[model samples]
Target: MTEEREPGFQEPIEYEEECENCEVRVAAICQSCGMPMNSAADYGGGNEDNNCCVHCCCEDGSLKSYEEVHQSMISLFMKTRGLDKERAEQAARDYMATMPAWIGR
Candidate 1:
């Protein structure tokens, strides 16, 4: 059996605004550094303009270049895993290749 509502009666709809830049609608980790941020100003390093976290930006809020982030990650990986420079670079390149273009080459 089915029940029907009045002709003019309609249920309300819900909507959520996600980040406009990184395409991440939900508050989550930074795409580059794994830091947490969202669209809120108080927490998660959220920035509504470019849709990125605070640490990922310069003082002016411009996003850091992809190469910078990639190099940092590679260095971190090398230091933590004890990988040689050549091996770390290749591994980092391979890993970044599987990520979205936003993560860079």
Candidate 2:
């Protein structure tokens, strides 16, 4: 059955696929938050472990809680991608909602 969408809900974004094994199958999305991870290799580069984007992990290579990850992801997307604040906020929420297993505490 087709589901109804909320008013003013934008469709999910389509991203490039230059990187391999991206979790979302989008070119430059972070596996954790499903946002763009377009920083240089030394800074948030993609890795074989789920191809998680650099920003998705801490400097020590630990994963952030879902809330923290999504918040940072939304902010980065807003500044780097010039996305609308409200839309980015919603996107962050939606992405987090889909991955409750990673959202510890």
Candidate 3:
């Protein structure tokens, strides 16, 4: 018999096949930045095992500090989105607040 989910519940995506460049299976999104991590190249340090994206990790394959990620996101918003410093900071905070890594803090 098929199982039924609760109201407003969503099924988790299950990745069964291994990625071409790494042993880890593809995940739905980066836990840190919410970026799609469909391919090995899209994962941090090019490893599909990472829960975060390349931008959210250091070259050594560790997750970046919260401040570092916050600053980078602010800078990115200011540069690419043409937001001013204050607005960029707010935008970054709002975005990061929704991410798993920064949800409570």
- Candidate 2 or 1, higher TM-score: 1
lDDT of 3 by residue, 1-105 (tens): 988643433333333456779887646577666777777777778877777889899886689999999999989999999999999999999888777667667
Indicate which candidate wins on lDDT.
3
Please identify model 3 stretches exceeding 4 Å from their true place.
1-27
| TM-score of model 3 (CA atoms) | 0.70
Model 2, range 13-75, lDDT digits (tens) per residue?
A: 334443455544444445455545444452243343333456667665566667678788689
Q: Using TM-score as the measure, what is the rank order of every candidate, best first?
A: 3, 1, 2
List the candidate numbers ranked by lDDT, top first: 3, 2, 1
TM-score of each: 0.48, 0.45, 0.70
Tens-digit per-residue lDDT, 1-98, candidate 1: 87864343323211234666876455454444544454455122344544445655665666677777668768987999999888888777676554
> What's the lDDT for residue 20 in model 2?
54
Instruction: State how far residue 80 of model 2 sits from its true place (Å).
Output: 4.3
lDDT of 3: 0.76
Task: Say what the RMSD of model 3 is.
Answer: 7.1
